[model samples]
Target: MPPTAHHPAAPPRLDLTDTLVLFDWNGTLVADTDRALRATNAVLTHRGLPGLTAEDFPAKWKLPLAAFLRDLGAADPEAAEQYWNRALAAEPAPLRRGTARMLDTLRACGARLGVVSAAGAAAVADDIRNTGLDDRFDVVLAGVAAKTSALLSQRPTRPRAYYVGDTEYDIHCARAAGYLAIAVTGGYRPAHALAAVRPDAVVDHLDQLPGVVTALHAKTPAPLGGTPA
Candidate 1:
């Protein structure tokens, strides 16, 4: 068996000061969540597999594709893979709000940015690259089996961290990976669901985001050996 890698211990308190901010692409930063879910469900229905419904999507949304599909009763790996491939091929639109300004705020504040999503790397790369938001993050990770694992892989470059996302998966990932989690109410799962994971904070809109980060991660530059990064 492959050796398991261990993650470092988590901080006792959730703090965002001078920390790197990681985001989940689909529901957090981009609007592709609905599009992808819809497409995937379409594939599931067409293949005679049970379709993934929005009401039930979040429950299994965190699982990696292979396992998620298998657990959902996609009898063959080939069929499951094909469904996802077709859905990705649709080339959907991105999250409509805060795509530009929010990123600018983070960068201007000197906060480093990264992404971790269950979405496949190739597809996420293409979306980011093509949409031009790819340049917004210093690091972008895809095909992450779990968001926690993805966050750990970049520990060398990221500072004390916080993750911004829209589902329980994101919150769970942040907690498991030793980072502060902040849930956004713009997507599939309800804010309450995300709160169930006990995220450090939660936001109802994107405009209020900067303040949330500010309040949590006050280690702003002048004191942290760097300026507000």
Candidate 2:
């Protein structure tokens, strides 16, 4: 005889009440760096310029797409931008591993969640719908030109706030907006790149976030910076 089916493991044990967590969309929640690289290559090849390889792309990748294009010697940055966006939408990327589970845990623990991204609204919306995470975020701010100002606008109605992302720029935005920065590895940037920014904490995976939050709350009500875990 087979055992009767029961629900999965224990209920979420972390108490994230009165906490707000914001996440960066592309590399943070969605595994889309490969898509970005492809787009970059498309632009470069079209312009008869040298393309970047996976090994060197991360170090060269920067925010403010316009500036990156300009730096790449794009003659018509606007046309290049259109081509890049089209390439990204051609095949949207999948969500990072444990993304849904982490969101569920955070919501179960009474945390408010949102996404702030530089990705275009159309792409972000398609991603949220395709990934079935449309209802996961309380607020979705996309196509943001200035992240620091954007991060500052989302005031938390809670006692503690955290920003989870994969880039040094994200750390800067989080800290500037007075949120505890939580960097996750295996995104757009490398671990060492994120580490040099001195984020409040760094986790190797998304599933580890709940534990980090628990420890931070239990040990230090106000989080100080931490080493990678």
Candidate 3:
């Protein structure tokens, strides 16, 4: 497991007692970075680019993912997208440890849950079903090129909504969409790397999430789009 950052003065610790919680599928809930890396390397090799090591992948990964591909010699965005989709389709990754427990805890606590992922709808749905979490999410937005767009389209009405993920991109998307961002470590990026983006909180394991959410909710008043002072 990677290090976890717990900044006492992080922003947007909105009350999530009745919040809508949106999750990013890949690194947030699924333990599939290794599988994803392998698939990516396959595509890189196919395109005659040098393969990336696991450690190198996270440090180099970024959103508007086309930029990352371009850095890897994928000059054609459409072709790169196609290759990535095909590679991922051939090798889908599995759920992380304690995924079901975390979902169950949130659901039991009455959090409206959803998943917004860059993966295709069918793939995300299939993974949810395979993991026995078929009915967990109220909304499942997949193959989202821009997560902020998807999030804004939802127009979440709750005073407290959160986007939980494991990358700096996730934090940016969450903030852009007016949701509190919680970045988890032990996924694609290291703790310090995630901390650089200054998410609301960072935890090493999903097991710690319920307590974090509860504590934040308990301390904060319900104000629409409230930011920490």
User: Whole-model Cα lDDT per candidate?
Assistant: 0.68, 0.80, 0.75
State the weakest 10-residue window (summed lDDT) of model 1: 1-10
lDDT assessment of candidate 1? 0.68
- Looking at model 3, report the run of 10 residues with the lowest lDDT sum: 7-16
User: Per-residue lDDT for 220 in model 1?
Assistant: 39
Better of 1 and 3 by TM-score: 3
Candidate 1 deviant stretches above 4 angstroms: 1-17, 52-60, 77-82, 219-229
Screening candidate 1 with a backbone cut-off below 3 angstroms (N, C-alpha, C), the clashing residue pairs are: 16-216, 16-217, 17-217, 17-218, 17-219, 30-95, 31-94, 31-95, 110-229, 221-228
**Model 2 clashing residue pairs (backbone):** none
Model 3, TM vs. native: 0.87
Count of backbone clashes, every candidate in sequence: 10, 0, 0
State the lDDT of candidate 2 residue by residue for 101-182, as single tens digits: 9899889988889999877778889999999998899889987887888877775456677899989889998888878888
Off by over 4 Å in 3: 1-17, 225-229
